[model samples]
Target: MKKLISLIFTLTILVFQMNLYSQKIFPFEIKEHKLSNGLKVIVVPYNSPGIVAYYTVVRTGSRNEVEPGKTGFAHFFEHMMFRGTEKYSDVEYNRILKLLGADSNAWTSNDQTVYHIVASADALETIVDIESDRFKNLKYNKEQFQTEAGAILGEYNKSALNPFQILNEEMQKLAFTTHTYRHTTIGFLEDIKDMPNQYDYSLQFFDRYYRPEYCTIIVVGDVSFNKVIYLIEKYYGDWKRGSFEPNIPAEPEQKEERSKEVKYPNKTLPYLYIGYKVPAFDSKSKDVAALNVISELLFSETSELYQKLVLDEKLVDFISGEMPMDRDPSLFRIYTRVKDEKNVERVKQEIYNAIEKLKLEQVSPKKLADVLSNMKYSFLHSLDNADAIASTLAYYVSVTGNPYSLDEFYQTL
Candidate 1:
């Protein structure tokens, strides 16, 4: 009877994995429900025996800031959320989660903040209750708020001393004149210094965002959609709606390309940055696929450029570039450090030539096909765990509202 039961369970898991790519099966297999108050719920069942991952994504970030001197409130709350709620004190929450064998944490980024927990499937409902309570009724005394604010300031100070972090802060400010993206997600030092005094603004900040409408819940692993949705409705249904939307100033077009050279006399090698702003990620954009291909051909160590710049000639420390994943248009930046200043323009021209060649016949059909095939296979290879799958879903959902674009992304090739 045990062997029969195990065989039946194996068949059931196979059925769900097969239906993962089906359109008609989409709603029932991996459910999405929106509450009357506009909260979004995503229930993903994996039946991976005993584990589950639950995440609440709030769609407010540093980009949502509009007040002149009060940037990074979204980031500030990432630290504050742990301080405590009226009902669930930090110690008590941790104690309860530990009792249930759950591990949880939260993160704030340029576009979103996600609070998450992973645990035995048995603890799913308890996790829901704790998170929903705080989302609706988070309360902190002034002293606690002030205390957390100082910690955020200290966190900022530590990051500011990092050379890469310092460069990015200055780079964003220079890249954008009017857009909120001008400031780093941590905001400017001058602004964060005054954050604690703006207590009233902090309260208003919570009121404006962090609403049911501004958040989405994702639950994955050994569970059923009905049970997860039922848990979501029980806990999150009554949370208030969000009324505010951010009005970040639109970035003006760059009329001419620009380059900057700053001698951080503290460094042995000179740092160089080459930047070009591009429209952000959109599901229908195959150009993004093309950009990925271009980057692979030009920037990888296997590429001719890397060997020439760093190994053959020993002119540059390394050549690297990245295309950001964002809901708003972001920059494609090429950064490198040279052994000496004499070869800066020479290396920059080579980088430009590489980009220009991508527009020409730079890649063979077999090579391009190999890259695309490798990309798809590599993505699937990482889906062996519940958290890996959930995190991948979260990444795409954070960029586009949809994650199943994984299919269309490959089909576009």
Candidate 2:
């Protein structure tokens, strides 16, 4: 009777997942259009009555910083973009944003830079005009550029003070040989210092990347798709496409495990990160899904490893794992903060043991089903607001150049 019950439960999960996969998970209808110059625009009309989220997803980041001595421009633009255009000075831009009651910010990652604005729905057209003008007409004199460069150096020095930052910087430097991922998004310390002197190179960098061909606009709110498209075309239509394409170097496979040690002067608990080279993210691949499940199974609080190392053995204060979604092959990393220096080796060995066990056995069907269900529920729950919806779609759009990729990704699970 117990066996029959288990079989019935397995069948039920299988049926539910099958039905879910056959349709889209995004509740709203996503409307899309591409300008003649290659700027992709996406709109999601939600029930929210008075607010909107605008995102300009630039499909360029430190990953495209492949040329020697040219790293960090992608991240630099995150600051430079706010310097404003000739038509709208920095002060005017700030004042306008304040008038509209908008919250705006931008961030650069390994594979993309995203600028977002959340404001009253009535201000959508003005927001569109300001964003379009800047992307096309961004201007900064050498003195202004140099001032920002100095600020970046100051920011970098401050970040260097953090042990966690130092560890992460060292880990990436050790992990990759030829890929741009070897450096942090902030680029090399030397390049950032030299940035002010490279005024000509700066213009070229913007010319190459700040083009319509490399950008996408996403708006989600209580809005109309037609009006959004019209406003986007009116403001951004004339932006020209550039012919430059960056040749990012492919990362070579690791033949042996790599290790690095950092001894910070500041006294703190020793932390360890063990990363295994993994394939690039593919939402349709079973291997990626299986790997994601394995990450949660081995390191989540519910895992036996966590119970042994933290709850009973008391070797670690915190332990977690991540398999980040990326456009290129990346790492599946396990991180731990150890309570005692002496227990570091023991904790590392236990992590290795967990990996070995996973290789030798399959996760039970019941457990796998539970994790997948929880993941789906969490994803659905995250889409509870306009900003959440736009941010979610922006991520998928950056990865696959299609917002519907989110639907396919969830269905794959």
Candidate 3:
């Protein structure tokens, strides 16, 4: 009996020490530099032997499309950027990528567009040269611009086939009244239809947002910080900065609860989404931490609600909740797919009941500690490779413009 007590006490001490160590969650030294031209660069010296992940985060998304008729230009640029610059034609760019055996792609979201490449470390110089050239000297004629626009229209049509996509579009339109978040990242269908005729406007959009001040370069892997900076200076130093500042409109407060129902053209299991207006992502906010905790406590697979709704009653095949990190105020959304259409209301009410229980009752300290520890360790386990580390930091850098915010956020949790 005495030995058992002693072992338990030692384990407790070890856990306490581990929790203290985890306060500084980011294991690598983050080196940052700013250029005279207003470009920012972040370097992480990861242990990968011969590979690196390069990411360029453009802080413009559909949220920056505030003009009357230009809603899809940001995503359009995601496609157009690959059309290649004057120095590097699309064919030549593809050839070079194939030579280096590189994987490269770009994606646009509500708040930012990110371009990423995973390649050998030896190819870093060529990567910098081509990327800098494209950002600084990209040129496309009217025909090329219109071709990409039409392609985007086709892409939009394809995405519209998904019922969840339709529901998300309606939700955004219903959620915000004045903010550009009223539109999805793909923008509206009408704007995409009009995109082919807006070749001149496309030039202006690129000129406005593709500037040094609105971008950040992140390099993670077996790389030296000083070497990365020197290469950046050699290639991107002469690139001039632009003086465009977007007037992004702020969303106003919701005075009352709002709901909308979206109908699907094809038969499918009924999906239910409930979103509550929540505070924006803040690294130091206790409210944000609490929301994160609540998401797990009330909706995780082990939660009473999930056990009842999914395991016991077998009403829902899937149910989950998330507080997505966004630069501006976003949703704390609970989502579920009901097996039967008639049970949608019951599932929703059950979720409400679970939320009310969370508000009325306090979780035991042991459970809270367990959840926090799991969340922290799960994140730590994901940083196993260069690409994973860069990808994780890219999202935080997009939202907060500081990779260190990950440490601050986890500390709060």
- Candidate 2 accuracy as TM-score: 0.93
User: Candidate 3, after superposition: displacement of residue 2 in Å?
Assistant: 52
Off by over 4 Å in 2: 1-22
Q: Model 3: per-residue lDDT, tens digit, 99-179?
A: 999999999988899998999999999999888888888889999988888898889889988877888888888888888
Task: Summarize candidate 2's per-residue lDDT along 317-406 as a digit string, tens digits.
Answer: 989988778889877777889999988998999987877676556557687677777777888899999999999988888888988778
Quality of model 2 by C-alpha lDDT:
0.85
**What's the CA error at residue 126 for candidate 3, in Å?**
0.7
Q: After superposition, how far is residue 338 of candidate 3 from its true place, in Å?
A: 0.9
Clashes of 2: 0
lDDT of every predicted structure (CA atoms): 0.75, 0.85, 0.85
Q: RMSD to native for every prediction?
A: 10.1, 5.2, 6.8
Tell me the deviation in Å of residue 360 in model 3. 0.7
Worst 10 residues of 2 by lDDT: 1-10
Give the per-residue lDDT of model 1 (tens digit) for 149-262.
888789998885666677788788878889888888888888889888988899999999989877888888998888988888998888879678888788987776555655
- C-alpha TM-score for every candidate: 0.88, 0.93, 0.94
